[model samples]
Target: MSSTSIIKVQVDDTQFKSFLDLYQEYQEHLESAPDDWKKVGDAIGDAGADMEDFADASKASKEFLLIAATQSEIISREIRKASAANNALLESLTKNVTAQKSFADQAERSEKHMKELKKGASEFAHEIFGLGSFLMRLGALGGSLAGLGGLLSGIGLKDLASSAVDTQRSARGLGMTPGQLTAFNQDFGTRYLDPGVLGSISSAQSSFSGRMWLARAAGENMGQVAGEDPGQLAANLAIRAHNWWVNTPASMRTAEVLQSTGFTQSGFNLNLMKQLGNTPLAELQRAAAQYGSDQGRFNVSDRNTDAWYGFLRQIKDAGNFIETHLTNKLSDLAGPLQHFADAVGKDVTVLIDQIFTPANLNALEDGINGFTKYLGSSQFQQDMKDFAGLVAAVAGAMRKAARFLGIDTSPSSSTNPASIPVNPGLDPDEVQRETRGQVRGYGGVSFADKALGYTRHKLNMPSDPRAVLAEMDAKNGLPAGTLEAMWAKESSEGKNLVGPVLRNGDQAIGDLQFTGAAWKDWGKGGDRWNFMDEAKSGGAYMGFLSKRYQGDIAKALAAYDWGRNVDKTIAQNGANWQKGLPAESMDYIKIAKILNSQKQNVRVTVQNSTAARVAVQIMRPQPNEHFYRLSVSV
Candidate 1:
């Protein structure tokens, strides 16, 4: 069941680019941190000078103060002690200022790193790219992420899935809001999401870049960029992408932009510079489209803006928030500065004598203690470090912009998925499994919805319907058209599956709408997908029931719908089993009679709501076997 669902994330992620811009702004923000910290040290020094001035003036007035005050020696000793501690506090402040400057300088210098992506960004890109590739690989098999894949991603209801953690905590974690990820999955047209997340059926962790992308896609109409105009949207993306490349110099195009697209399928793969790189917008859109039909065709560029400028706008916003946060935190140092200034701003004589008292000495002791703990607390240091690390990460991500941003157009053999996690739930999308290779001209939409839409087509009864019906007729040795009417009633000739993963027991599969339990119990151990297999297997069960019911076709059909337990109803009703039959089952017989010419072709479809299963799949045995097994097992 482990597979992947690719979002077809385009090249030139605007969110990522905006993140690059954030790196620039954050770098500027970090540069001032050292100087900002230096100002704090200077303020403390000025306060210290005020204390020294008071001490000097107090010495000049020492004789007068001795005349005015008792315990003069004690007062003198306290004055010396307080003055010495103030000096020590100033010296400690200077050292801290130097350390802060060093860290800020390093963070600032890291911004100048133009060639290499930092570790954080490298890790982020690895996960996102890995997840995308993982999805593509899983798309080959056809299952789902936690089996929630096709149903949720197909219809934009993936948001309903719970990200409940289980035995193992996830590797790459969820991004921000689950809603945004859901929107991104929908807008991005992804069926499967996340990697290496167990216990979670749908979502995986959102890496830093991924968080910004999902957030941007979810925010303020960003995900709605595909506004009801597919043709125009496709044209707009092509024009804008080409316009951005118009200013590019030959050297950059040759060195950087040439190999940008690589093997990644989505994004602006347009190469204006190359002699043969000219892929027309219409043709390019056509090539990228999943299915050829008008409704089914999906031009990745034409579909959504989560991969382009909208993403960039979000990155800029996030960067602004980070920059403002750092500057605001630094400005808070003014409070301590003002506190010290107020203490030293007092009048000379009264303050000088008061400064020698026990309370004032203790206050001085507090100020000195404040130099280490208040100015250089562990919390503040950690905050600075965290912000600095993030700021440095912005620079790291910027370096990768050149490599992944449509500069490389050549297809590579494979991608490096080492950085991405491997989630066991990664599986094929719901469409592939439900359709089972028979693409009905519908874009990879939900199979159940597809069937419901084709209700009229089923009622008309296409040529293919006769093939399975004839097989059932020949196998069961029953009257012709009996199974045809039944098939039409159940699923309009296999037009729909029960649910995406056959998740509901009431929902069934194949031409017969066989529940997992019924398929296993009566299908005679053949491929459930094959129409002949289902027909023959189903016919034998019907034949057996027909013999048991004394050649009564109506009684046998009822037994098929209500399970073997329907015998209780027949026994209770004695010779008149039809007396106990529900209206829904009675309709089933009447329609079969009409279609097969056992009676008139009155109604086009039959009603058999009593379809039941008495067993379940062995995977995780359910308590109630009568309740039936779900399609998720199938």
Candidate 2:
């Protein structure tokens, strides 16, 4: 471009380019604007064209403004609708969260209830077993009150079964012969309901039920098998197998054990029996492996022989027992039998798929709820009160008979073995005669008084020395009655009472008979061998032994008898700790175990029909080492 003319042309070109840029910017704005705004812009442009064509420009522009206002209102309405939809969604989400929390709370409460029910069931089972045994024993002894059986029946164990099974059904299931069923009803019914056996069954049930609840709570399968309380079935089978084995001739039993392990010890035999009694599934399997195929015991091919006939008879007897007690035509008793079995066995889990099926759990829940209501009822409490009064009446009648016979059943009457009532009543026939003989005999009182005074003072023990020992047991974590029995063996209540002096002439002294050497180190001082000193030192030593031997009571007691340096004594004694002990020491532990187990408790009172108080005395039997007895009135 030229200088003057070219400069003018260039400036015009630059202005044209700026105009093009503004046009491009306007087009871009039109493309990006809202559809409604574009419509408004188009109407405005049309209004402008109309104004350009017509005379009223103000009216046309007013019309265009009205259109734009209408478009703006539509856009505002749409925004408001979207906002309302979002608010509704937020509200729905909030409600859902609250509902979830409520559901979670309900679940938590359900779990807690289940836990409590399981615990309660276990405790109830234990008490029921104990009470049942007590009542059954009384019945067996011909002293059972009519109401005791009624009380157990009221608990309604029979109502739990709904699988169309009973004793009759069970017999059919087992394919039992009619003769076998008849025989079983006679023999098995008498034996199966024994108090001790019932106690074991109750224990098994508690274990099984507890495991079931625990597994369900953990969201795990309760048992490995279907259709059986595996624990109980195994235990029952094991028990039967053992009983059968044990009943065989001694030689046969010996051969079986030898075949299983090549060598045997008493401990091993005891352990084996215990295993059979406990009857874990694994143990059951092992028993089956060892004994399942043995036809020698069961062989009936030689029917003419006495042994063969006896074996057949025994089999028939056992079959009868099972058919009569555990099986029937109406309902299979297998379920109930298994229930009892599981109660006695260890490591029992509930048969979740079997006993704790949905239907059964529901029934249990209902039963528990109903029982809870019954317990709260006044009539139930009244029945318990009535039962207690009846027991008192029976006890009173017996006591009257005892007193008329002039038997001094008092706590302080005997000292060699403390007189405690084993069962308070007009003593059993044998006991009554013995008590009468003792009364007619001379010098029994004189001997007891002299021994009691010295022994009571020396031990710093109560008139009821056993009670004092029991208290010590609670305070020091010793098993009940262990220390008292130990004392009894050491001093026979401080002087061998009626027996010849049993001292080994080692100058042992005090209730526990600490040797001079041990007394020097532990009994405060050698010369000061007193009851308080002996107890403190002995307890500490026992604690040491417990820690060292991992609470094996037998081993600890053996070491105690062997003297100090228990480890050295154990080393010298080899495997049998009792080998080198003096006869008295050996005898001491043996007697101690028995004496410690002696339980004589009496809770009796006399109240007349007129509600007048009569003589109230509680007596326990004072049993000597030979279980010779004297009665005590407390």
RMSD of each: 50.5, 41.6
Tens digits of lDDT, candidate 1, 194-307: 121111212211133322322232231323332212222223333334434555565665534433422011122334223113434444343224212322221222123333
lDDT of 2 by residue, 1-634 (tens): 5655534342448888999999999999887789868799999999988877776767788899999999999999999999999999999999999999999999999999999999999899886575456445645644332354355345432221211123334334433322233233332223231212222322333456533432332223435312333222333434454554555565556535533431121112434444443444444454334233321222222223334345445645855774564335215535554655567453345444467678988999999999999999998999897676556655555555656665333432222332322333222221101111121221222233333334444556446656666666555555566677777665666553232111121234456655444556666652223455556666666556555666555556666665443455468977775675545346655844664467466444443676544555434333211222343323
- Candidate 2 vs. true structure, TM-score: 0.21
Q: Which candidate is the best by TM-score?
A: 1
How far is 78's C-alpha from truth in model 1 (Å)? 99
Alpha-carbon lDDT, every model: 0.49, 0.49
lDDT comparing candidate 2 with the true structure: 0.49
